[model samples]
Structures are given as C-alpha cells and as structure tokens.
Target: MTQWPISDAVEEMPPGLWIRRGAPPPMFSMHRHDDVEINLVLEGQLHYLFGGEPLTIRAGEIAVFWAAQPHGLIDSRTGDMCWVHVPFSMVLSWGLPEAQTAPLLSAQPLITHAPELAARIAHTAERWGEEVGGSDPGGTADAADGPADEDGAEIALLEIQAALRRILRASSRARPEAPADGGGSVPAARLRQVSDMAQFARDHHRSALTIADVAAAVHLTPSHAMTVFRRTAGVTLGEYVTMCRVAEAQRLLLTTSMRVTEIAEAAGFGSLSSFYQHVSAACGMTPREYRRQAR
Candidate 1:
C-alpha cells in the first residue's frame, strides 16, 4: 500500500468511455482515471487503499469512485479486478435523455456499492462485446469488421445508466431518515452538512434559495460546496434538494388527496409552472402521471 497523488491540473474527466477486465497479477501503475470509475470484484476479494483509507471489497459487490481520487487494488487473495470508467460529462449527459442533457449537467460525482448492480453491468458488458465485436464469430476480421466503436460505446453507456436508475430508485425509496456514519467523520461532517442542507432544501426548495445560501450554512464556498456534496453523497446540491422536494411531493401525492398544485406548493414549489417542469424533468411525466404510477 502506497500513497497516490490527488488534486492535479488534469482534474477534469474527459468525454470518452472504456471498459475491460483486468488481467490477473497485473497491477497497472498507480494512477487515477480522467473520469469517474466503477469497479466490482467479480470472483474474489479486492483489497483497495483509496483516499488514504483501507477498503476491502468482496466478490458480488460493487464500488463507485471519483476518477480523481488516488486508488489501487490488488489480489492478495486472487489478484483479479473487473472495472469500468466513464467520463463525468458522459455520466451527466447519460443521466438524462440526449435531447435534454445541457440543463442537467452537474459538477459532482456518483458512487455506489450494491450487489444488484452486478447483473445489469454484466448485461451491459455483453452488449458492448457484441456491438464492438460484430458478432460474426469469424476467425479473421479487420477493425472495420466490428460495429463502429462510437455506437457500441453509446449503447453500453446507456445500459450502465439504466442499471443506475434502478439502483438509485431503490436507494431513494430506502433512504435512511438519518445519514449513515463512517469515513472518519472527515467525510461524515460533510455528509451531515449535506443532510442539514437537504433538510433546508426540503423545507425551502421553492424559495429561490441559492448555492451561496446553502454553502454559507456549511462554511464552504459555493463551488467547493458542490464538490463536497456530490463526492460525499452521489448527487448535486440542486439535484439533492430537488430529489428531497419531489420525494416529499410523491409521498403527499400517494397518501393524500391534495391537488398537484397544492402538493407542489407544500413540497416547496413557488409556482405551478416550476413545479410541473421539475417534476416532469426528474421523471418522464407530469405530476399526475407520477401520482398514477405511484398508485
């Protein structure tokens, strides 16, 4: 275990994608990707020293991490790793339909470790293989014989997002009333800050609250605030707030008979138009549709 560097000039992730399995006993030189990274140990335990913290991920589990964080994994037990890297821009764009990506781009990160994500990942990887390999099962073929790499990559990325939606939906539904504890209170303090800000957002999302307002409460600069919020909790401050309000509205929509406008206002919407826009954007439909689906 050695220290890898962080906070470099090449901090931003570029907009391309790559996926491959690690060859056993091969430890790539210690370095970070220029994008967000997701790694799952498929067949054995993976010992990782990341962000100066010791973490050991077992088989059947997954891990999402910032591409900028210093990290490395080795197989003392099996020396094997399976991994995927997606650019931050790609992830934010992928989070929404292609037509609506501009407005949804976020300056944050996302990470998770759930066993259920594995199957979806395997499906994506298989699609990638077919889309790139051209499926001829032929012995000899040129690079052009494969499907266009760009198209194949796009399909794979979309599948990754589909899996993420399921995982995130389950997560939001099972969101703990309180934040969990770990990460040495270093991250925990920021997590608590995010929780406090979330509570505020839940109560005041429609109030024209600004990033500055939220950052002030937590003693971080607005730009810095967004980074801490996302890296710590896997969503942007704005998205987090929006998620809280919409989730509350969902609860109200399902449990009570309030009209959508009233429910929106109660959930911190300043106007029916904004409420409709946000709810529709977060989900693919209007509040009425959301409520109907909830039922």
Candidate 2:
C-alpha cells in the first residue's frame, strides 16, 4: 500500500510554547498534534481543511485553534507567517474564561480582527525567535524572576492570556456569519472511532503495536477499524503507526543525547536496520545527520 501523508508532531519547547516564523506548507494529508496552535499571518492568506471544513485567515489576522483535531493546510497564498504552539497543559493553566476556552476546545478557531494588537503579536514573535536563536541571555530570565517583574515565561503566558481575552471580545462584537460548510460529511460515530484509534496509536507508539491491537482498543474488528480509519483519516493504520514512531524518533534525536541505537529501540524499532530505513525515509537524512542539522 502507498504510504499515507502524516503531519509531523510539534515538539514542546521551553516555556511550554514553540514559536516559528515562516510560511506554512501545503499539507498533503490531515495531521494532528497535542498543542493549541495560534497563527499570525503577516502577509497573504492561509487556507485550511480543518476537520474536513474549509476555513480561511486573511493577512494581519490571528487565528487560534486546538491542534488535537485533524487539520491540514491544503493551500496558502501567504509568503510570511508566525506560528505559535502552546501546549494544551499550559492553556489550561492560563485559566482563560470559559467563553474563550470553549470555542477553541470545540474546534472553533478564535480569530481576532483587532489590528491594534498586531504590533504586540509581532513583538512577541520576534522576542521568542531571539530567545530560540540564543541572541538574548535574559530571554529566559523572566522564568526565574519573582512574581513582581515575572520571568520571560510568565510574561509570555500573561501576554497570551490577554490576547485570548481580546480575541474573545472581538469575536463577540463582530458576530461573523458562520461558514457555509460547517464541517465535513463524516458521521460522528466514524470520527469518534478514528479519533480513538489515533489517540491509542499515539499513546502506545513506544510499545509494540499492531492494527489488531488498535482495533481492539476501540472494540472494532481489524477490517472495520482499517476501513473506518482510512475513510475518516485518509491514512492506513500501519502508516499511522509508522508516522507516530518516526515522530518520536525525531523528537529524541533533537532533544536528547542518547545513542542512535538506544533512541531506535526506545522509539519502538525492533532492529537498527529498520530504524535507519524509516528515519532516513521520513527525514531525508540518517539519524546522526538529522541530529546534527537539527541542533
């Protein structure tokens, strides 16, 4: 079978957020990550197939959505963008009002129309980029500061919280008409099955797993599970499993000093040859090379 296109996992960075500045690539397949994603479009626009529904964010707009849902960027007219990934745990810790949190959790992106906030967003992105690039020694200093001045991490959290509030206010005031296509035609039961199976695979990818095992987790037969997952997710069970393993391997390679062989075994590869083959195919580089380039 042809391999399915799986989205790469977003690694968690310090301060419980990952920030990047770039244009989003067109996604060949739907992908999900365990983070709350915020996108600030600096130029052009972004088109997304989010949960089988079409959504668009124009230039200068900030859109925030839960990354756990199956979302894909099928097209874009944007040349520049800033992406922020906040861990779900951090989002919860922010204690956002239910009005803002409910929509995000329900797969509804809270889009802001307040152009006034654009400069602040840009500055935040710039500061984060500097910190990640190691241009500022005091970048993480806020993390160690007391409650008064706060650390950089604490300041970031507060800024994000304030942004959410502003977004919530903007959404309420605008009351934009809902999109014509609310979502796709996939039945809820089928979606639940596929989501359950995918969650299972993500949770257990470090251990030995199989299609049958995934099916059993959702109490479905192997054939039924395969059909439902493919229909809803557009990926085969085995392909999804491989994607999970490869993603874990990538994380380990970038963040840890563990030996390649150890990382291979830890990421659920049965043999070194198999690990090398999968990592090379997915990343276009051997493990050592990937680590070097990533670092």
Candidate 3:
C-alpha cells in the first residue's frame, strides 16, 4: 500500500473552546485529534475523506464530527470556512440528550441543512475572529488574552450550545448512519499501537524523529510498528511524521512573521530544499506566496 502522511491536530488551548475563521487549509492528510469539530461552509464546498468514505459539505451547511476518528480534507473549493473546536469535556458538560450526542460519539458527523443557521454561525465566527484579533490560521488565538476571559468564554459556550440544539432539531428527520471505520477494522491492540505512535509524532514533530524512535515509543519493533500503523492508519509511520512537520511549517507560514528558513528549521526540516519541496507540493505554492494569499 502507498504511504500517505497524516498531520496531527493537537495543541494546547483555552479550557473549553477554540474558534477561528479563514480559508480552508490545503488538503491535509488523514489525522485525528481529541476535540469535537464543527465546520460551517459559508461560500464553497468541502470534500472530506472522512473515516475512509467520501463526504461533501456544500455551501450553507454545517457539519460536526468526533475529531478523534481519522479524517482529512482531501479537497475544498472554499475560501470562507469557519471552524469551531469544542473539547470533548465541554461537549459532555453541555448535557445534550443521548440522541443528540450519540451519532457524534459514534463518529457520525451531524450535518445540518439549515441555511439560516449557517448565517448565524458565520456571524458568530466573525465576532469570534474580532474577539481574537482576526483569523488565526495556526489555531493559537492570542494566548495572552484568549477566550478564557470569562465574558467571551461564556458567550461562546452559550452560542455553541444553542447552535448544537438547533442542529439536533434540524437533523431529526435525516440522521445519518454511523461512520464507517477509517482504519480497516484492525484489532484493538493494533489500534492502540497506531494511536500511540501517531500521538508521539504529533507531540515531537518539531524535533527530528525516526521510525525506530516511534517504534520504541509504542513498545514495538520497527517493522512490526510499521505493519500495524499501515494496517490501522492506512499510512506509514514515516509519512505521518513528515505530515506533522509539514503541517507545522504551514501554520508558521500563515500565522507568523518568521522567515521561511526559520520556519523550516523550527518545523523540523533537515534542509531548506526539502522544506520548499514539501511546502510547494502540499500547498501548490511557495511559502511566500501562500503567506501573501493567506493574508
């Protein structure tokens, strides 16, 4: 099987929620994080390789998913995307009914077809963007004064709860089936090994990593680790490492004033040539161009 990289989407943030508005990122490889994620498409379509199945969310739609499942944005024709990341703990605290939370827990993305709700979401996203001082492509929204401020945090939580309830109402007649497994139904032990390896890569992507290091982290031999990761994640361990590095590079490029060379080093690239090669291949543009367009 061909090895594809998987980016990791874990970062420290304010306790309950994180929200951002911007262009959809370049096609990301399969990855999983611990948050429950919502995507509100304002003006274009998003195509996802979600749990190994094809799903397309068009303009004027909102989709929520359990981000712990392997998923990626393989394609997007959208320039305006609003993403809200609510921690699982926060979701649990919302006291939503079983029917409302069951599908997401089971990995089924609850998509609402309410155009009015989409507009409301977009407005909330704009307010959030302003609250955080505009689009934060790197997901770090003013760490000094983020949503943790009591008033802003409370408003965001209330807005999210209302939005979710509205979605539950809209989806009553069209609830989707549980999402299919993304990793070809592997054994639980193998899944844990792969998850561990993926998390390790995410945690240490800023440093040089090797297959042997990742294998040791998961207490498996290199070859056996590779086999398990491939069978369960549909990607090789090496590719996943590269994906994490490239993703960090993209984030720095779009969100910081750091020079390209600096970003390359900070993102764990061994050489400027490799950094340029990977960035161009992933984003279809040079880092400078990407930054300029993103701004």
Work out the TM-score per prediction. 0.45, 0.48, 0.51
Model 1 Cα displacement at 190 (Å)? 19
Candidate order (TM-score)? 3, 2, 1
Question: Which residue pairs in candidate 1 collide?
Answer: 75-79
Best by lDDT: 3
| Stronger candidate by lDDT (1 vs 2) | 2
Write one digit per residue (lDDT tens) for candidate 3, span 13-82.
Answer: 3333566676765433555666778888888888775543446899888898867645667567846778
Q: Judge candidate 2 at residue 37 and give its lDDT.
A: 81
The digit string of per-residue lDDT tens for model 1 on 1-295 reads 3322222111222433545554333344333444556666666676654422335777666655545443444333553455655665555444343212211122222234565566457546655644554211112222234555777656755776675555444333444532333323233344456545654554466567788888887788999888877765557888867765665565456446788878888777768887888778866788898767645
Off by over 4 Å in 2: 1-16, 25-28, 131-150, 176-295
lDDT of candidate 2 over 81-139, digit per residue (tens) = 76777766666656554344445544346777655565467567666544433211113
Candidates ranked, most accurate by lDDT first:
3, 2, 1
The ten-residue window of minimal lDDT in model 3 covers 1-10
TM-score of 3: 0.51
Residue pair clashes in candidate 2: 142-151, 142-152, 143-151
- Which ranges in model 3 have alpha carbons more than 4 Å from their true place? 1-16, 129-145, 173-295
Against the correct fold, how does model 2 do in TM-score? 0.48
